[model samples]
Target chain A: MAKKEWEKRIAFLGPEGTFTELATKELFPNDWTIPFKSIPECIEAVDAGQVDLAVVPVENALEGSVPLTIDYLFHEADLFISAEVLTPIEQNLMVHKNNVEKYEEIESVYSHPHALAQCHKYLYYHFKSVPLSQSSSTAAAAQFVAENPELCVAAIANVAAAEQYDLQIVQKNIHDFHFNHTRFFVLSKRNDRIERDEDKQQIKTTLMIKLPSDRSGALHQVLSVFAWRQINLSKIESRPLKTGLGDYFFIVELLEDENAPLMRGAMEELRTLGCSVKSLGSYYTYHQK
Target chain B: MAKKEWEKRIAFLGPEGTFTELATKELFPNDWTIPFKSIPECIEAVDAGQVDLAVVPVENALEGSVPLTIDYLFHEADLFISAEVLTPIEQNLMVHKNNVEKYEEIESVYSHPHALAQCHKYLYYHFKSVPLSQSSSTAAAAQFVAENPELCVAAIANVAAAEQYDLQIVQKNIHDFHFNHTRFFVLSKRNDRIERDEDKQQIKTTLMIKLPSDRSGALHQVLSVFAWRQINLSKIESRPLKTGLGDYFFIVELLEDENAPLMRGAMEELRTLGCSVKSLGSYYTYHQK
Candidate 1:
């Protein structure tokens, strides 16, 4: 295969047919994408300059944050989040084409643990006694079912997975709750300007902050810095520092741009109080309709 | 078996050999316990009067909060947390006794997803090419390996599981970090006084707060109620209300008792601000030494 000059090389978390692939295609429709085995691998690919950008999931509305992505970005990588893609997660119950008629005889169900968890109610109602197995990813689960047609197994994955693996969608949108969305981050070594439709795009700035060890009510003070400045925080989460129990660094997403003076002043004030603040990125979000 | 006069019928998240069982035994050393398949079942057992109390894991140092326990506590059950137990978590790799010499040839590793994730580095280094499977719990994984001795499989579980399932420990303390602890909550219908050695016991109060929807910086204001009063908060986390994205209710743990004037004042102020505040419990923590 020859490289197309206009198409950029992108990396995503995948074995293909995963939600990350959908997000990657949405962000770079014509580009060549390389699928890595894990979120860290995709990030490392971008950090090592093997790809122009890496698209990886950061948070899901129902399941909450993907700690591995946040922790890696904060502790290891020097990459910047150039853009974000918010896509509604639709988990479908799929099976090999041969077993589509024997859906009631599904001996086991397979998916990534999170996907299995998201469709808990549907699984309980339909396949109450069926063994639920975990695979490395939803795509892997679909691939497994596709390869083993003799086994009466079903997988919960995206519709794209069904198409990729030649599986049948027995049930669609089987996730328990509505308004379920996953936020994916587009990462690059440099904060490159992304070319996208300007309409309906919203800018958000993310910061990782570590409070002073000796101070009491330090988190309250950190929030105070923003509260007094009238800056609204879209999200605030604390992840373990891995040093010990009760030691955490917060990932705060602000509803403003990185260049905003108020945000900069707040970070400065936090630093003055011995809090270590790092800007993750100020990026625009593309919402999937 | 007939119920012993003094033995309390307690329910735990278990199939026998799980961390929850250990916590249950620590809290009620001589009580009779019934194992439930999942966290919700354990809570429901207590709520339905099938058991006197339910012991469930609420948080882990490495994994953060157990959202199922917290969500079920807030959304469904009317139970109150009567006591808390802090236990050190030690993950071990075990295999059937017959495969002690064949450990290197193990084809797959099985455990609860969290356990497998906690030992990420160890698994990557030692069994790089092996497939990892998920069981309902670590105990179930050990039991599976014990039952399927014809297959070379290893399980990541606790020492208790190794003894219960008649397996050999291939590796000890396989978890990546030290000081890994899981906090368990003992739930009962009433706020009963727990009998224990009071030495080294710490009193803590937990509150679940839903901020006014119309206000910006509402979390900061909620924290401000305690900040000016000099009350300290040990932990603050937000779990989804499950209504939609970006809608969350904060779970704040205070380093004060429910009866403390400052704590009560803060709750009152929050209510005045149109915030719905619910006191989950005020309990004493017993640390396993």
Candidate 2:
């Protein structure tokens, strides 16, 4: 209940129509939210007390971990995840209201490269011979297509963005995978820990660590503590330590109770491994829609 | 000997005027080249025999790996890397040649989202009070800025793109990292690998694999082969196997010699791990003016 003691102003990466805005809204409905232009800024705001909490996109199913978000989380201190949100995304095929051509006559497809990528299958099947132009974002693409009547291009954007651009939807749900969800974490400056909630089935603690150099079986030795304790790992990703090419930093999510016997044993073993370790925070994912 | 072989058709990701186009010209000087809209299509062209070779972006110092390119390499068959190029990147902020003001006075700033991300520092410093917009590519962003002269907007683009759009460089070298370089790989359906010349100093091989399930020490155990062989890993990443969460498909890169004894032993031990393994190819990066 420390959350109530704090005002809990949540900060996120955004400009209102961005996906991070959507993710942040999904987590804290009533909390005051501020938008930052970059992940580092969001983290900095949390650290500097400009905001009480921060939400950052960590990974996407198709694109892997967002590297900048990973880097900031790895280096940031005095901040920990207060909660998490998994958002299932549906990107639309958006075009300007002025365009009045059938899908077959469309000459080009425009979107942010990532949006273009997410809709690769649809473009390949329908517009295999047509040109695909990259815009800065789906919203920008729509704005571009709005002005370039000569381009006859459609952009892959969100329904909200389509509405914002007054664009029509030519097609929808074009991503290759049906379950396209992004995992986001809410960060807090305060060190208040999460109380175990019985309603949630999957409990995950997200952490970052650096292992010793010139060592063999170092990571294995770290993992064994968890496996022996019967704790399951939800995810593990390694980033360059940023010190050099050969060095690395790892982010892991453990699926176990913080106070569980096996988990405590695992943490002890991890500390014994003699590496720089920091607990980002623990949160649960609720499968119920 | 392949270098002396007649001629080869190379595919690159471009419509011309892209960083990929510039890198392609460097890799294949005056060779018959076909440009594809995306990296996947370029690889598909090589796989489908439409072209003998293709070039794709591998990793960026600022953005880490291009996940689709790696995932595509993981799934590609009968292909090998012939060479690589690391191009230094310099991002520029541009606007319509007409209006000028601090970024705060502007309503929007356009660029490829990646470009936006690279110049995020500058944008945050200047445009935190304004709106930031993203287009599909830097070129598109420049073009958007060119057309929207009446709107107080700017874009993060490249010098070449600024020239193409007839926009002025509002700022240059806006990326947070000064040593930003994107590594590109030249791939071929033919097996003619590069013979190390005096210019070559180091070699890297791209590898894809699946780690055994619930095996505590599996990845560490597998890495031992490389460590024992003194092989330095260049990169390692994991994508979900897509069977479900908790399962992963991993991609790794490490140094290699065509006939090194330790390298051979490492490959053998890696095979014994009972995982899906694919080698993209081996190549070296050399300095270029």
Candidate 3:
């Protein structure tokens, strides 16, 4: 197990207790895990062959898409999505246990911006005028609360973060909605390098396509190719082409067989209609264990 | 002049010198300008009849979208787009200027996350590993740099902020792209109170539509209604409905007349096709003066 695990080195955006790390542990429990400071760094590690895969959050429920991850995947990194992991984002108000009853005495709280935004209502009603500080990640916020004995400072992080840092969760499941979750993509140098046996559950293919900006019904035509073939779409969203306002590329996710030949035909048809398509990857989704 | 100005009170997300404030000044040059802390707070002020209009950024070239502002306008705030302001996002690296020659002496820098993101390349190359901190706004970061003169710190803000806080601009226009700009929506409580005169130069109609999730070919049908009408879309993007995964609301912008009867027909058609449509607003785009 040790020898096999040594070869399957996975990199994730982390410092431990992060959602990415938590998701990584669920999917690759026996594999070796390394932590990278940023999403770019994590993907770059995988691209450079320093690690076998990179797991990073692609989108969240309330916060919309994770721009840095999507942008890096699109323009910066030359990696493909090997697999995807969906994790329930449960943020908690964690504090040092020594001052457990000091809710009234708490002066400020810390969290990542998206976490803070997700738990906005809870923070507003409970903390009121309490100043909220931002950290790079939720685990970093938890680490701050753990390292500092400051009773007035608390952190909005996950249950794992509380346990990892030995902090007490003052409030549990503080996110605004119960359905809040984040989707993460596991990245690798090559799409088919991983064995297809274990991940035979279901495949979802993601593609980025540039639609003819000025053409009327361009998006409809792009979708018509799928709709006519009875291909069901799980998700579709557009992002700016970065050249100017109003110009965009569509990112669509299709829950289909990994090697569906229909997708290739669709791409060819789209190109004939002056659309450019790039397949992000074809992979299966993993839920938290 | 003062009497007219006093009657036209405007609220913007601010600690002063934010892009919202700058855009507000550009459009409402003579109007009384007030500052609110959060996006919701600013919009709420407009909804509660506290201000005439609220100026908040809805999207940026690099950031993709400001989900909070868009979501609030969609679900929470009963506001309409009175005007749209486009501002060039010029991020400047500012410092106290006491230690003139000591680049290594700069210990930390502060800015809003988006501001920091806009200047990512510059920060990475120049600051190296210098700690980057987050504040509520770019101007608030400038204020932090101004107040904490003893600390070896810099800030990523705008020229207006640097002047407002009396900080020295160490480097200007640090953002990676030259065409980086944010689109600000002037939110108003009364949807049709503002006259269609000065804003009549151009009209861009924005709408939010909910497509029946389980129905096959639902979105393709929605686009067909507009496509056949020769109604071209300027921008289109999907955001999570936040109820569950795979549930989303499409926000589409069309370049047409403010009172185009074709839109009414399109809305009726969309409703028949099982889509709930809500008009965000119609207004002209504001460019940097």
Candidate 4:
């Protein structure tokens, strides 16, 4: 079979039916999509030129940052963020369709650790005695339950997973918090400027910063440049530099475009203070309603 | 057995033979230590006055902060950190004594997700085909391997775990990072000032700060208060406030005594700026050789 000329290839973190896949489908409806088992694999596909773009979850409202995606982007890949997608996360309790009537008899529950933790209160209240197990992902748990009919297990995943794996939803929206959402990044090898949709798109620039090791207030100095310019920062996260303990490089995301003069000035000032600054990308964000 | 007047009870995150246990033993050599299955349980036990103090790992050099410990302290428990213990981590590969000769035939490896991740390169290079499973803790994995000798499973744990479970060490120091260290906090119900050990002890004050939501450069201003006074921050980590996405509270550790005039001035300035500041504790840190 030959692919159509207009159909672009996209890769997402999945075994299928994961939130990343849902975000991919929403973003690239007509594109040919492929599923990679892990975040690194998804990013590698784009870096290897196997796919035109890759979509992976970078942060969850409740779970915080996904270290793998952040670390890979900072340390390994030369990828750029083409766009950001915000998807609402709804975790559900699902069981195999064949065992729908026996949902109460489930002896074990399975989910990705984050998903399990998000629904900790619910699980503790309802299934306190059931043995909880960790799966590589929520979709993997659903797939496992789909394949093993004799094992009375329930998986905490999204509604898509339940439908894809032929599982019945025993409970819906079981996550502890209502404000659950995950931010996914659309990664590409090229640093092409994203086309902005007026009134809907907002520009964001993410910078990886390393401060001078000996400085007493290096981080404070770095933030001052942006502070004086009134550049609003959406987030600032510190990741280990991997050299040793107490050594870190920060990831700062500013609500400004890459070409903004203020941002450029901040970068210049930071560099003057012996700080290493790398621009991850300046991309437009899309909210999935 | 009834406890003696001089002996105090302490709770740790463990089923026994964990790195936390090793840290507990070093910090309180004569205390009666109890092992709880999880971090929350250990902290809760202390909060309920079941133990004199609780020892829990707060941060690791390689893996970053232990969120459970941080979140529990910030949200649930009204406990204060009495002391900090820095322990070097050494992960090893162990198996049942009966399976020593059949090490090559091992079908699966089990360990805590962090331990398994720490030894990722080693496992990928040597036991690429072996299925890696997650256990509640590294010690729990060792105990499982010990009890199930017929199952050719290996556990990545500490040397203490191997000895406690009577397992054979197939490989030693398999962790990828040599500078691996875990910071454990000795938590107590009362905010008792720790006696300084003079030369070896360094006083650290940890503050939990929540910025007024509407302020633009609130974090920058908060840092400026410390920056101008030259208060060295050992670490600054942000955990979700859990009210919504983008809402966060910072856990800042400063290298100064709690009652320092500069510290008091900074706290007062922050409070005047409408920022809520809570002192988690001011404690002395001990390094275990």
Candidate 5:
């Protein structure tokens, strides 16, 4: 049910060699994937029809949700997630190829803040006197290090980024844990459901729900609907509504195939509670080796 | 009663003029306040007894919990929260006073990423072509602009920060939402129960909960105890366990003073459910005029 050739262009968070780019390459290895500096820009490009799809990291195994991605999809972007891709992440510290004693001579480290957080333990001990400068993305930092050629300046990115920028790795696997991974949402203007083989591809339906205000036990009742219906919830995220201190809205991902009958029933039950629901989309989550 | 004529030291998110520093100044005007680069460093210094108290931002009405602050308190720090300060935020864009033709000469804008996000509308419409750079703190950005004297660089901070950094306010009230307020926690190594007037100062108990893996509706049940006990929850935050995808631990703040008998029973009930609970501390929330 898939074609071999198409002039489809995808946009990912990058300059190059970001985890989003890795996910994009895994899913559409033959398609052209461009990089955007920001998540909103990448998404808006898809909505404006400049790209066939926007690959953006939505969640991390270690860091929970990426706030920018979640906020964009929930309140700003009109695009839908056509697919989700998960990539195992390995963060490395790379420096200019000409630099000798990279780690010993480093005065400052550059990376996306999230990357810095992931490598906190390493950075705190290793770069004791160094300041961590923020970059737009990990790859962008690598690109900067490649261009600057400073022994005192280094970046925490990926192996692909090292290759892309022709930088040399001073340290490998600098991330906190070995089980690090990130989930990327393939956003598209058209969210038509694709035919899936049941066992081969499992469908996941992600929805954003605004819990009814001024009600006690509203959230409990909302969860009860799915719990009683035996709909397995893969994830539930509560974000501030911003109206007040206690207000919150939840985003849930239900593990089910397309047009899941029980999910529809749960949605109906949620509506009865006056909860507003937006279906992010139903798609086969792509699992990469 | 606390002593009147002693040297009190306070640590805050710094290098100066940050909202946390403002909270610190408001709470301890006559005391010595120092700036630490990160929340962990500030809190750690307090825990290590280097400082009497650490003022850190815990929650924002608009953006929800500060993950670094929450996670640091929950998993790492052994400190107790002594007071909560709520400050209505006013984000201002500031630049060097000598700079002229600000908008046309802009190359890169600077601020804490959250500040940039808060003023998205203003930044997008005004500096569409300019790239947004992240700084350690909004005040740090303002200080950078003040020191650099670069016509292209500006920062989003508060009026207090603008004055401290000797930067001119380019725009006032640039924050998207006027109701935005951040809740700051004044953390101390000592969790002493101070006598409260109750009428003037409300007691707030914050706890961390780890739901049992064996129980399906453990969280719902946990809420039921609160809902039944009529203990109001001021906030609920879920952070990653960092073990795997879909694993989380929740931090909740109950709108009640320390050692409420009903909350004790609720904690016992939670223990029966095999859920682990830790009381971070109960304190009278401080409000600044």
Candidate 6:
């Protein structure tokens, strides 16, 4: 295989072991992966020429679209979605190996609040009446369990976090959903001119739209344009306009390109509906090897 | 003042000085407010009869909606929204009094990822080059800064956290949006029955609907019911169904109770559109005294 370009540093939201970090590694293998503090910072870094690209989670299979990601896109119209990747999620119940006995006598489970919530059913099924210890994140929870070996405590985290902390996996894949995956968008300050192969399948474009009011059929009027053109819409969501007076905004993903005639017609119809829409970007989904 | 008859025990998601704790206390005065690791656990305690009520965030004025709150509601359908409270979100940049000189030569700012993002403009305008350190929550970040006073570090957190940690406020109200407020839902397992008074200004109900397919005007057909009845919709969001093939699920909120004759007529018309609709509950908004 030919060598890939490596000067492009891919920035992500993280501190060593967040799911974003894992997704970064999976997406750009050769590029340098640097973790920023927040999604806006990551996007700003890309905007200010500090980094070549950034990757952030747009939506989750179990939870929904991340509001931060949506708001950042709607507010700052500079960043664009270059590509999309989905990462499968797996959560583990972990404890320090030194306290193997404590596992059997576990009185409470400690984890990042979200991790604990995701695996709530499993914990309740096993330890029906035990108290839960909530930590900031899985890594912190694992670190806590690692230090407090004398206590009967368990942590729910990813297996990678467990390995990094030198903890043993007490249980595995404890999330309520079987196929939990997080959808991530790869963003770059300069769009990479990657040529599409003949085998490229489905195409999707995401846009943010602000309607006149919360009037009924307003959204329908916007969707009908795509319907008339026979273009399928993959997703539609409403977010607060943040302009006060109970105004609303919508983010939509259409299975068509910006230049497509049908999409152009849809934009015209959306304008007549008195909706202000901005195109985020169009990209093809990447399949895992 | 006469004391209320029900001495409900309420559990909130927090350590001690989290904003959630503050909101919970304000929502239920003269009642017990216990701290829990997570919302799910807190809600579970209420379900198990250990606590009489729980407080969880449903949305934020600036950040849109909290996905975990929505997903938890979908999973735990038995609980109903008893009341909704809006708390103004004011984030402070806090640090040890002795660390003032170090801030000029500071290396990093520690805080929850959300806090960091909300105050992004301030960070970029002033401490743009400094690294950001992500902790689990703002309270945890404050605690970390308190314990390591010698380090050239600061934290973004609420005023209560700063007070509890004995840290001085370096900056105040550093949020990107001045009207930042989080809307919390007071949940109860008792019953949905509530004595309505004419004094109550507005009541909102949330619904999740799964559409038939990706056909043209699919959503329009569903929304026409509300348009015909002139019912106002507060919010609507769509998430992937995660069934491998491209399918989506939509969540909607109405500004009125669907049980009322006019609203019920609108809902009946919506059901005729042939879709799966799930009701969350009708709740009265909490006004500050």
The deviation in Å at residue B18 for candidate 1 is 2.1
Query: What TM-score would every model get versus the actual structure?
Result: 0.90, 0.71, 0.89, 0.93, 0.87, 0.73
Each model's iRMS: 1.3, 3.5, 1.4, 1.0, 2.1, 3.0
Instruction: Give per-residue CA lDDT, model 5, range A202-233, as digits (tens).
Output: 68888888977757667667778887777767
Q: Residue B223 of candidate 4: its Cα lDDT? A: 95
Tell me the lDDT of model 2 at A261.
Answer: 75
Better of 2 and 5 by DockQ: 5
Docking quality class, candidate 6: acceptable
| Stretches of model 3 off by over 4 angstroms after superposition | A1-7, A92-110, A116-133, A149-156, A168-176, A193-201, B1-6, B93-110, B120-134, B148-156, B166-174, B193-200
Q: Model 6 RMSD to the real structure?
A: 6.3
The candidate that wins on TM-score is 4
Task: Give the TM-score of candidate 2 (chain A).
Answer: 0.84
The residue-by-residue lDDT of candidate 6 on B21-66, one tens digit each, is 7687776667877888887887788888888888887787766777
lDDT of 2 by residue, A50-153 (tens): 88788887777666777877887676556777777777767877666666666567888887787787778888997899888886556677667666766667
- Provide the lowest-lDDT 10-residue window in model 3 chain A: A192-201
Q: Over the stretch B1-289, how does candidate 2's per-residue lDDT look in tens digits? A: 2443567788887655467756777756767867688888999998999888888887776556687787777655567888888777788877777775654477788777777777778878877766777676777777777877888888887777778778888777888767677778888876566554766768777777787666765666667667656677766677766544456777777777634778767777777886557666677774434
Candidate topping DockQ: 4
TM-score of 6: 0.73
Cα lDDT tens digits for candidate 4, A112-172: 9989988999999999999999998999999999999999899999988998999999999
Error of model 1, residue B28, in angstroms: 1.4
RMSD of each: 3.1, 6.9, 3.4, 2.5, 4.0, 6.3
What's the best-to-worst order under lDDT? 4, 1, 3, 5, 6, 2
- 3 or 4, which is superior by lDDT? 4
User: Which residue pairs in candidate 1 collide?
Assistant: none
How would you encode candidate 6's per-residue C-alpha lDDT over A1-289 as one tens digit per residue? 4335755777887655667767777657777888787788888888888888888878777666777788877777477788787777778878889776567678788876767767879887987788888875666777788888787788887766787778899777878877777778888655442234643657788888888665566766676667667787777887877765246688888888877877887887788878887877788776433
Pitting candidate 2 against candidate 5, the one with the higher TM-score is 5
Off by over 4 Å in 2: A1-45, A48-52, A87-176, A193-196, A211-231, A240-247, A256-274, B1-5, B15-35, B75-78, B90-176, B213-216, B228-230, B258-272
Error of 6 at B162 (Å): 7.5
DockQ values per model: 0.60, 0.19, 0.60, 0.70, 0.53, 0.29
Q: How high is the CA lDDT of each candidate model? A: 0.88, 0.72, 0.84, 0.89, 0.82, 0.76
Tally clashes: model 3: 0
